[model samples]
Target chain A: MHAIQQQYWAVRDYLSPVLKESKFKEHGRITPEEFVAAGDFLSYKFPVWTWEKGDASKARDYLPAEKQYLVTRGVPCLRRATSLAYTDADEDAERLLSFGDSSGTADEWVETHAGRGATVDSAANLGEIDDIPDLDGDGLASAMADVSIVSETGATVGETPDLDDIPDMEEEGLEDGEDEATMAPVVPKAGGVIDASQIGVANGNLLQVRTYDVMITYDKYYQTPRIWLLGYDENRTPLTPSQIFQDISADHALKTVTIEAFPHSSTLQAASVHPCKHASVMKKVIERMNAGVVEEQLAARKNSGKHQDKDGKKKWGFGRKGAKEEGVKSPVEEEEVEGMRVDFYLVVFLKFIASIVPTIEVDSTTAF
Target chain B: MPVVQFAPFASLVQPGFWHELTRMKIDVLRLSEDAITVNGSYSVGRSIRDRETGHDIALGCNLTVGEDAYQKAPQLSPMSVHTTGIFKNFNTIEDFKAADKAALINDVVSKIWDSIITTKDTSLLTQFLLITFADLKKYQYFYWFAFPAFVSKPAWQISENGWKQADEEIQGHFQLESIYDSLLKTTRSFFLVKEIGGITEVGSIEQYEEFFAGVAPENRVIGFLDPSALPENPGWPLRNLLTFLRAVYPSQTSSVRVLCWRDSERPTAGKPWRSRFGVVSIGEGDPTTKPSAIGWERHPTTNKLSARVADLAPMMDPKRLADQAV
Candidate 1:
């Protein structure tokens, strides 16, 4: 049955229609050429991501040698998904209603776990409270001020032993900074967009930290970028597959996330966020951002009316802010209906992905 | 008081670092296993605390190196300190596995010890070692990262309540910003912090000898851009620094204040940069005797003292890429 399903997928992938330029804006899918262009733009803007070539043995002819896939390593996952405030039913219902109004597909949001985005809202509350006293019962001030004797070790200042004579302190590794002491959870600032600077300094527990090495590959059949994740524990040890699942939202863990062998590597298996619904979701996000663009343009148009063409040279700015007027409603306005540039496709895609995996922190740098 | 146990340095090798190694292997370093100097960096620890679970998450204390690891001089960034390390890429996985890991670490530690006794550049104490074997055919890499620190005779101890937040001592954001800016300009990972007539000052590592002689012992504070986020502990780099201090300082019994200089890489409004101040006492070690070092990274899952593997075939394998492409 698995072999049959694989065959069916292969045939379906081969038969899938190539994304047309017109549908690219409407459907949020792209051709291989467009994928490269978008990848280039993303890498240019955010240097955190860079293109890389796979093994010479598995090289793809469609993409350039140096640009086979994109990767950003050591993306910190400060907390587990469950640690974030759960998406309340009311907020989920509100999101479903808005998604229905925009894309007429509300159930898709519930199915994909993409709508479990309560953390993104909380993430925005970063940087409001600056000096939170280390509420870790061991008071910060008292802990630093108190003095104690070190008579237990029995070694005085001048009569210390040589380094060679010292026993292996590997067992003492536990006492080293991996202290089990906990601090009061941080209450995020009430309202604001997340600042990239604050993303690294947020109130995260040092004991349970995890890091993710992320990979973004263009999915040929789905016509979208697919993300793969390999996580490591605080000690930089690789997290088991089940351990990785703990960081992923429960909604998407068993559903969309699949453990499969990556196409470029032969020996390793990684968890990949399936790209099946990426196109439609990306299309909805693009449209929403474009609507925001239109609203801003409308606001600009209203503001520009105050200045008017006082000099009579038609100094009025219209759609996209820089287009010239040629009487028949500038061609830029027509394009403005599908306003956002294809270069921003990956940015929007990441924003959608962030909602699904709120703790991974890959999108924090790119969101702005 | 408890022994000052340092948080181990976590190695975060960027994929680009491997890609660069691959390129150098094919184009420049074909069967060579010579030691090459590479640059790595660590920033102030950024962690979050969960008040609900009371779980303190250590965001990362990563000694990271990427595509720019091969650069001769660091392009200084405000967020992190660009420290130096040695990289040895073996030709085969067997060579990587069979090699005497202790001897390899000792060799690097010996070099660090030599530099500490001879060089004025205290930055030399921050040296680390990395070994790897890239299986180009399989797109896999077997690697180990070790941050060597000599075992002190009298283990360094954190005096009771020895560490506290230094937001006030440093004055405020303006002074902290100035100090952070100076840190980048000097490019020294470790420095001497002195208070000259109520005005705080930071000096390069070379000045520690003179600074220690001139200042009162109570005011002897050494600062490093701390990589560990945990409040009670310092990062792995401090281990070597402490060892170096014991060798060079004039006093046999030195009670020095340690400033774990931490700040947000990009300071946003309302979020001020903060640091920690701790008092630690180090006893003199026998300068002639070489200390046993510890810093081999543990294997992620097996929890054994073994090398970790990374398979990049899906991204690096050409045939696989082609097959995945439309």
Candidate 2:
């Protein structure tokens, strides 16, 4: 196993007892395929500052010297971990089903389904995965007959199936009835859930149940993660667009981007939608892009001779002399004007997702 | 010694009237050969009568002689009768006729003889004559007799029995003459003449000059000479007599000196005398004195007596007296 995989298991084992005391039910353990898939997702979405072997000095020389190095580096890692923990792909379906059964009620069926392992990606493909083929090719005629009977009984009784019947095919249609009434399917989009269980199979590893009761316990210790992307219009007036897209696109370079997360109780699916991780990476990329854009704008103005004084002096007017001395350059003209030159800007993006599972068991006899 | 007698020598002067009166029925004898008998007499005749019988009353009368009878008698002696016989009146002739004439005559005769003969001795008669003459020299005849009469009565008496007894005893032995002598002695011996001249020796040539020196020339010294001492104008001699009297008997004549000069000059201006002799005489037994007049009288003369003091020294100018040395 990879060293990072071992660390993940250790952290999981350490937190498992605490989670169990808090009534977190785990159906099984996580498969190695899931860990790799989660790692891939984190790597793509939350990249760290990279340097060549000798480039450490170069990068250090290039980047602005700041006192808080960990704040600039380790914060990205932590944010990434937090987001992955809330990802819907990390949910355990069987655990959610068992949770539903222990709850002993059916009124929350729709909410339970929504909170389960189904992601936007899997939800959209519900139509293709709706029909399950039997294990033997006898069409599972008796099991289908029992499922039809249980379905009929569930329609009549509006209650969960018996716990003993859940493994039997008789309770299948009973659970199916509840799913059809509550969970409306979704269409898949890009950058959606990537199934890590499949990776375990391809790697010829024995399949683990992959049940993880990832409870995103929140307290004042964990603050809400939010991203604030500051931009300006052509008039140099500050702009805060309520529409997230507009805020991201309005400025080619974001001036000030920050991400913050609130304290909350959520599943890993909810945490995965947190924008803190995305916000950290996008901040650096946006800074470079904005620096280029502003420099271009400043150059264009210079070329056009738009900013000039009446005395025909080039007016780097942002930090210029006072009106009394038309030609005399003030000290601010060198320091402030030079400093305010568009070196960089930043932009932040954030997403958080939480997965919740509620499992229900319907009694096949109750359907009649 | 054989009694060989010589005839008397006759004087140039004839018997005076006093000699003729004193010689009546009296014999003069020379007791010794050298003795001169110039006969003089003093005859005192008094009539006696029985008041109730209205008849001539006679008692045996005789003349007894003294040795110095004639010489002691003054030339102008006056006769004086002093009667001491008592008479009782019956208020009726029958009652007088009824009385025993022989016994009455004997009684009358013995009493008259006893009264007359009692003063017949020589010394007694001499003293009588001397006293009578001295009195006559000082006062009138009436005063000489009246003074004895006035003084003989008790002048004052105490009403209390005890004090009355004492007064009686005092009167029984009292001698007015001795009292007079004491008064004179007290007066004259220290008689600080309240009068100016009486205070010092005065009326002599020396004292006279001193007195006149104290007077202004315009002022005269009027000497009041007594007329009885005629022809002599006896100023100094009389004053010497008074001094002799005071010296001989200070108490009898000391008061006499002041009484004699009581009305004399007072020593200051506006009076009869000027500051004569400048001597102040104080009346010593002036009831003002014997408790002692020295302090009271001397204080007045030395301090309060105002005198027209004159400078008597020949060398002192009269202006000096007016200069008010005080």
For candidate 2, what is the DockQ-based docking class? incorrect
Give the lDDT of residue B151 in candidate 1: 75
Q: What C-alpha lDDT do the candidate models reach, one value each?
A: 0.61, 0.20
Model 1 residue A90 distance off true place after TM-score fit, in angstroms:
9.7
Model 1 lDDT per residue over B1-326, tens place: 67776766768876557777888898888999999999998877766533323334556567887667887764434456788888999997667766777778878888888888877356667788899989887666777788877777667777787677766545555556667677756645788777666666788767776666667766557888788776666777777787777777646336767888776443556654557777887555564466666667754434445566665554455444333322
TM-scores for chain A over all candidates: 0.61, 0.18
* Candidate 2 residue-wise lDDT, B30-80, digit = tens: 111121223222222111221112221111111112222344342211121
lDDT of 1 at A68: 84
List-wise, what DockQ does each model earn? 0.06, 0.00
